[model samples]
Target: MKNCPNCNAEIEDNFELCWNCNYSLTEQKIIDIKDLNENKKEIDCLRCHVLMLYSGEYKFHEGPKIGVLGNIFEAFVNRESFDLYMCPKCGKVEFFAPLQNSEYKFE
Candidate 1:
């Protein structure tokens, strides 16, 4: 905690404004993950005509996973990052994009 310049009150480092005094904190950036998620565009499947699912984020691993006895596993694991909306009828998967690009989007 640091002393507020205006009132000399102790303020947490993570906070933008001091609790005791309305002191402006500089050199801090506030990122809103919810706003970014809400603004992301959506895409739909053309064949299924239903909204696709948002598969999670994926990363490539260089080495294979070894079992207890040193058994090598070839296949990689699927990592889900974001929310996915899959088609109930066809089970098509899609990522968030733009409404114009997607076949299904809320008007």
Candidate 2:
């Protein structure tokens, strides 16, 4: 196990990025993922009532087959990506749809 330089969080040896603070060990710095939209909405933590920090973009990938209803389920719930936000104090995480391109078409 290794320690993250930024947040001092314990990290696995094989992992290059710090999960707690999003610090890149290889790059030796924190990864700042910014939103492309100029008028980005600031999210507040429901529990803490403090402004949430933008973590990064998270993408969902299809996993193994889920029996006969896998295709049908994927068709109905076809979300691909989302913007992740985290509360600095309470470690609360929230997911929001991409602000730049709100429309998503499954193809």
Candidate 3:
């Protein structure tokens, strides 16, 4: 196991980049991306009770500045991308992670 220099989070050896802070272990620098969130799941919207549409992905580029809520997501999602869902009825959006040990790809 290794620790990320930016966040000091424990990281497995298999991963090249630090999932917690997007730190590249080899490059020793932060990587850049348009959006960190990668849409990879499909589900029903809770409020509208309708199937949510699979939206595109997003990356933080810069971490959220909203304080606790933002920090929570930063920790949960780490630096890995996440999937997004939008309600067709109410336009509500949701985020989720890709399944473990699965070959699911974004369509």
Per-residue lDDT for 15 in model 1?
51
lDDT of 2 at 93: 85
| Per-structure clash totals for the candidates | 6, 0, 9
Candidate number with the higher TM-score (2 or 3): 2
Query: Model 1: per-residue lDDT, tens digit, 18-42?
Result: 4443454662333232332454444
6-102, model 2: which lDDT tens digit per residue? 8888887866667677677888877653432225558778998866677678988666547997876776554578888776546678988776664
For all predictions, the C-alpha RMSD in Å is 14.1, 7.0, 17.9
- Candidate 1: RMSD over Cα atoms? 14.1
**Least accurate 10 contiguous residues by lDDT in model 3:** 33-42
Question: How much is the lDDT of residue 40 in candidate 2?
Answer: 57
lDDT of 3 by residue, 1-107 (tens): 78889989887776656655667787898754223323444466799665555655554444564765875666655355556666644557787655552665545
- Candidate 2's C-alpha runs over 4 A off are 1-39, 65-79, 102-107
